[model samples]
Target: MRSCIWKSLTLTIGFSQNLWAQSIHLNEVSSLASGAGIASKPLLLMMGLVALSLLPFVGMMVTSFVKMAVVLSITRQAIGMQQAPPNTVITGLSILLTVYVMHPVGLDVYRKSERYMNYRSSEFFDKANVDMLLKAVQVSEEPIKHFLKTQASEKNLQMFYRIAQKIRKAEDRPSLSMNDYIILVPAFVITELTKAFQIGFMIFLPFMVIDMAVSNILMALGMQMLAPTMISLPFKLLLFVMVDGWHLISKGLVLGYPL
Candidate 1:
């Protein structure tokens, strides 16, 4: 009687387990069907948040941010005061300057995307079309691509285009046209870096002259053990301030862009 009762209990438990598994499997299938029929709101919002988080990185890569940040950092180094303005201060200034230079481009992108933004706000997930997202991206990328193309030199474009042809498969190579973002972004980056270095070199010149002059005076006075930077730093700062360095730099950067 005990064995028979135990056997009956085991069968009941097995049946319950099978039923539970079937329900779970059916629920999963239904969820997939529902997901296919309508886009998920929470998922879209999460993706949008992620995209927003990456905006700074994207700005640094494609905009004048790289050039502004690099030049400003190099200028600080040239001044020989490692912690005076501070890295945070330098970065903040660079970001602000970049925004100033790219304001027109930003306005254009916003204008192009206003309709989509309004639609998303009004309907949220109800009107969310995957095509709308694609359209928004496609529309936004055009102004940025145009800005990059304007900044990137012909030689830089040719170099990347040639490299793309070599590495990509023949069938894919045809699609990788001269105007493709893959070719354009790297070229634009290199161009920005080149311009930054060119500006940095100019920034270095006056400070470097001051250093050499200080070093010579120290040598002549037989104080060779003293560092030139210790004397030249104050002079560099004075000169920079007298000339209103920030205003001049901001002006040049704004004017340099073809916008």
Candidate 2:
């Protein structure tokens, strides 16, 4: 998970390189031949720090984290569990499952950018070379981009692409291509959310039936004063345990992502 998060940060840096370029003065580099050595390094470090600050948001959106987290939360609710697993446990399990699924993509990013990552301090930092950083980020981002493209639904992609075109001015519309990360990320998120809800609906069925049965039994017994939830909770828990729900849920969520 850490690896994937860091790799995603590199992609964020790549996306913001133009902004970084704008912040630096080109005349300073022209005036002082060693300006890159003195000035560029600190600016790059600051930008990297900013990228780190956005890590959590980027990490959650691009990975299987959202789908896993949402599905787990839905599972807890369906089981009539208000707090037994706790929010923390659900979040931790989702993150771990995301890590398991994304580990390969992280490794791919590392392998692709290994040469830039392992540069001698003198080569990478001693000189002011923003191109090297840009190239590294670009190389690192491809695997993640491919992952998003694969998981994102074509219907959502087309929807977002059309929306992006509609929002942009005619000339700018041509610049906003279908493959852009700006378009892909939102589409990917919507796709994941749609899948999570579909899975949640399936999970809710049996438990819903249990609740209905308990409620009807109470009605037949003329026990309207008693809460049906109190009666149904144990049966829901029993059914969950009997089917080994946790194992099945974990397996399905982990396998849902393309590793």
Candidate 3:
């Protein structure tokens, strides 16, 4: 009886010791995981902050802001009102117009990046969510790519393709596709610039005629000392107001993009 009791006690003690060892190991793992998680959070936050800072510039490249701003600036120049609306006003107006035009694209991106949209900004300190954030970014970029591709001219795209081919190794050069932003972005920008200039030229024509007509009248009036621009400015403003120039320009710009 005594020997049996001794063996049973020994077995119980051995089992308890094994359980204690396992508990200690689990605690160590938990502490290490928490430590690593804590350490990584600040790094993620810094990267996020950097990305936020760069987002506006990225926005300018990918959105209608480039074309809108250029056209608006040229319009202001055409009106001979260099600073009448002010630079801040022009930039703000351009941004508002860009947002208006790009709202559908934004919605599409948000829908496609549902994971990102669902991500709680309140969880800013969470390190594990970084991978999800990156995945969201990748998915979100697709819609912007679509927008750029739709607006980008094929000839301009080919031009950038040739340039990119020259820039990279023969083996590294990828085929020109909307999927590649490196080739697509410059092409989209140049295309926007070309279209903006074309619009600007049309805007200039009416104003140019006004200036010339005013110049001839002044010359016949023996008023060479007075600038034609000064005399024509009031008449130009009157003509623009009569035809609702702002409304027409805004309508044309909004309508220019394929629905």
The TM-score leader among the candidates is 2
Clashes of each: 0, 0, 0
Q: What overall lDDT goes with each candidate model?
A: 0.69, 0.77, 0.68
Q: In candidate 1, what are the lDDT values of residues 1-259, reduced to their tens digit?
A: 5332222222222222222442444233223333332345455455345545555556577678899989988888998989878889988988888878888887776676555544432332233433443345546656767888889999999999999799867776666667666677789999999999999999899989999999999999999899889988899999999999888887898789866
lDDT of 1 at 96: 88
The C-alpha RMSD of each candidate to the native structure, in angstroms, is 16.3, 3.9, 17.7
In terms of lDDT, which candidate is strongest? Answer: 2
Model 1 residue runs over 4 Å out of place are 1-50, 120-129
lDDT (10s digit) by residue, model 2, range 88-121? 9999999999989999998888888766654444
lDDT of 3 by residue, 62-113 (tens): 6788898899899889989989779898899889888788888767765765
What C-alpha lDDT, on a 0 to 100 scale, does residue 34 get in candidate 3?
39
TM-score of each: 0.79, 0.85, 0.80
**Predicted structure 1: lDDT:** 0.69
How does model 3 fare in lDDT? 0.68
